[model samples]
Target chain A: MSVSLDPVNIADKLSLIDELWTQRKIAGLNDYEIKLAKLKGEFVWHTHPETDELFVVVSGRLTIRLREGDVVLGPGELYVVPRGVEHCPVAEEETAVMLVEPVGTLNTGDTGGPMTRAAEPL
Target chain B: MSVSLDPVNIADKLSLIDELWTQRKIAGLNDYEIKLAKLKGEFVWHTHPETDELFVVVSGRLTIRLREGDVVLGPGELYVVPRGVEHCPVAEEETAVMLVEPVGTLNTGDTGGPMTRAAEPL
Candidate 1:
């Protein structure tokens, strides 16, 4: 099996990303994948029917809009959107985030639309 | 299923920990767990035969010693120790780190010792 010995610099990899709402794969942990993304504006409401999604804010601010309420996160903060929970992400300003989820999970979840983009290696 | 709506502030959760080399479970992603730990000394060499382990340095420096070479990481840097790889972690100074691995994975891996501690929720 091939193994990566090189360390991944989260900030450095994020610096290479220019598009908002696009995720770049950084590493893999078993059946899951770790990704980095730059996000801004509002994203479509979605839900992963089979897996939970983790969002860790790296810079700026991110607001996860749930039907119940809104969860705001800053740098060094993280929140997990439970499986089958409908939620939309909104960023008033540019935000950098790290995401952890199953390898084949989609960004738009069951509500997939035009915002869906496959995460590629950085 | 209970879903945590509150955002977990990594720095805040880390501030509650006082013991070095002890892991505190911060969150859960599917069957895997997200943990936070503080380190300042050498850890025992061990290997997980069934899973990969991810180490993300939140502050200070971390060195992962492998048979091939040592992978050093600073803040905002991360490294993954592939399955069945013998490795040891060392920190010269106080360092805060985030670890992601399978739920039942132990701190000491296959080589259990006095240094091994069960990760408790924060």
Candidate 2:
């Protein structure tokens, strides 16, 4: 199978679901992976011990709950969750976001319950 | 100097310029930096030898020209330039884009002409 070299349109390629958040890999670099997620409801509080995670809101609003305070992100807005910083992302309505993290990063960092899943490449 | 931990709005934070492409740093992580750029016209041919570069178009269109082919990206679209690959980015009109790369990575890779600039932190 020949791999086609094409630019990934995150909004058009998002794997949207109703109940839980869905993640689809847009591209993989040397050590990093770019993934797009459609999110609703709340995700588990987790922390990446090894690397920082970047969340860029593509559309809609996403609130990242932290111990210190809550960070709300809108479209074109981004926040970096420092390594080992516990964060739970919550969205009142449907939101689309692009995530940048190192390869092999677990979706649910420390807590891997029912929501933990291996990302699927788009 | 107190650094505020707030989300950065790429669309709102973009430092638009009339001439050559303009880039401004949005945030910095452990090993990577997020930058927002407003571009129009052609950029010099360059290559990053050590790390791959990511380009996520926030709005408008951007075309990355390579020796073999060209990749055209639209809003919400992304493309990764592999390490050591020579590429030239050109935008016919004003375009807003977000870039991800390792810290200390030069804007102009192998070739540093007039456009070689040290990124200014936002």
lDDT tens digits, residues B16-106, model 2? 4333465677887668898878888899999899888899887778999988789999987889988888889999988888889988888
Candidate 2 lDDT by residue in tens digits, A14-120:
74433357667779877888888888888999888888889998788999987777899998789998888888999998888888888878889888888887778
Model 1 Cα lDDT, one tens digit per residue, B40-89:
98999999999999999999999999988899999999998999999999
Once fitted onto the true fold, the runs of candidate 2 whose alpha carbons sit more than 4 angstroms away are: A1-5, A15-19, B1-5, B15-19
User: Per-prediction count of colliding residue pairs?
Assistant: 0, 0
Q: What is the C-alpha lDDT of each candidate?
A: 0.93, 0.82
Q: Candidate 1 chain B — worst ten consecutive residues by lDDT sum?
A: B1-10
Best by TM-score: 1
Inter-residue clash pairs, candidate 1: none
**Native interface contacts kept by each candidate, as a fraction:** 0.85, 0.79
